[model samples]
Target: MILAPYYFNEKTNLSEQPYRNQKRRLEGRSIRDLPLYSQELLDRIRLPAERDLNDDPCWLRTYYDPSSEDSWGQIQDYIDTKIGGPVTVYNDSSLYNFGSNWEKIFLRAPQLLDNTCLFEEYEEYVEEALEEGIESESGDAQHAGENGYDPVEDENPWICFYSEYLFRLAAGHIYIVDEKTLASEGPDAGTVLVMWYDECGRAIRYYREEAMHAAEIANLAPCYLKDYACWDNAEIGESYEWGAPLGPPYGENRREASE
Candidate 1:
């Protein structure tokens, strides 16, 4: 769908550390108190699992900003030209279902088709994995007993509700490109590049420091898709129980049953 341009205004502040502000907004809330969205939607928009991007070789964290009023106008123009054409923009509130992580434009292209084109359409498969992490100091202090050990206090409690955010095309025609790599090579390496594209995909007319005026890089690959197989061979067994047969159906040994 074409997002209403009215929603794109000066008030919109794009930040790389989106989670920091969102966590602050929901400082004391529990998972039960969080807003609701389909698990499918969360799977599409949520950030990559720690196992995916945490150790990936291509992973780089950077930010980009439009330098001047003229630059902002150019970016806006680019988005405007793509709408109301054969191209479709897959932008719905569904993309921003994860609390305030997404700053969606309120009034844009609503005429476009509202379908699963935003990302690859996949059948629903719910798999639950338990995540463990070290406890924060505050958590340790909160439940710490005078005794030497506190089972609850010994480890920090955290819940990984969903897997990492995989980059999906909005209606198989649009993409939000992270131009940090290009910006790093340009004049302002510290700034991040957050550019939205149309059916032309990855083609953005923006100022690259190496160039005098705005330039366009078309047909950029979608690197946001992670390869899950990287850690699949690590032999991390399916269960916490020791030597309990290697795969799923952890309860009884089939061989023992046959005997």
Candidate 2:
């Protein structure tokens, strides 16, 4: 999902006359010709990377017209035909949006405040389970207690609780549609069509009004949490073993984990 500017043959000057003469046939050009045709021009025109049309958010333009609301159905239809199955279209707010993004939302620090009531319930459950250690006759509940009853030590307890609440919070936000349903009938709006097709192309989870652009999701979420959080008695240059420093790029332990 991370995209960078892919370069084309720099010696080819496409803007002058040869390419402009083929304007009518531009739609017929394949994605392989994009660097030689489109992005070079976009960069020549000085558009930012987010609007570069080659990136994820803008890349949707290659599939359907963002300006057209009806394109959603066209998207579903194309997938259906390719997959040879009935296509189902749901809005971005539908039940089909559950995925990695939903998990990230719950795992973020801001979620601790967003779902306070659920966290309180988790705390109560943990307290009760710890108190009822040996005598709890419930099979699964008793089994959970046998593992030393440490929520922090045995990551499963909090994971189970967080996952349940995350599912509840994410309901009606995930959307699903049939494969290749994207180009249902045909598009009249002149939006780009699919540049590439994979038989195993997974359904993309999207938001209605928000693009969930990579920069916004990956960079902004942690900073937003830092801004709203309390920083009492915070010391600088202290190498904490758990979390990163209270600022943007919250990834102090990231390299350690990867290593």
Per-model TM values vs. the true structure: 0.21, 0.18
Poorly placed runs, candidate 1 (over 4 Å): 1-67, 73-106, 110-115, 118-218, 221-259
Clashes of each: 20, 19
lDDT of 1 at 30: 52
lDDT of 1 by residue, 66-99 (tens): 4333443434354345232222222223342222
Error of 2 at 125 (Å): 14
- For residues 8-111, what per-residue lDDT tens digits would candidate 2 score against the true structure? 11212222122223433565764456667676775554324322221111122212234334655554344444333222222333222433232222221111
- Per-residue lDDT, model 1, residue 6, is 11
Q: Where does candidate 2 stray beyond 4 Å?
A: 1-157, 176-259
The prediction achieving the highest lDDT against the true structure is 2
Q: Which ten residues in a row have the lowest lDDT in candidate 2?
A: 1-10
How close is each model in CA RMSD to the real structure? 20.5, 20.7
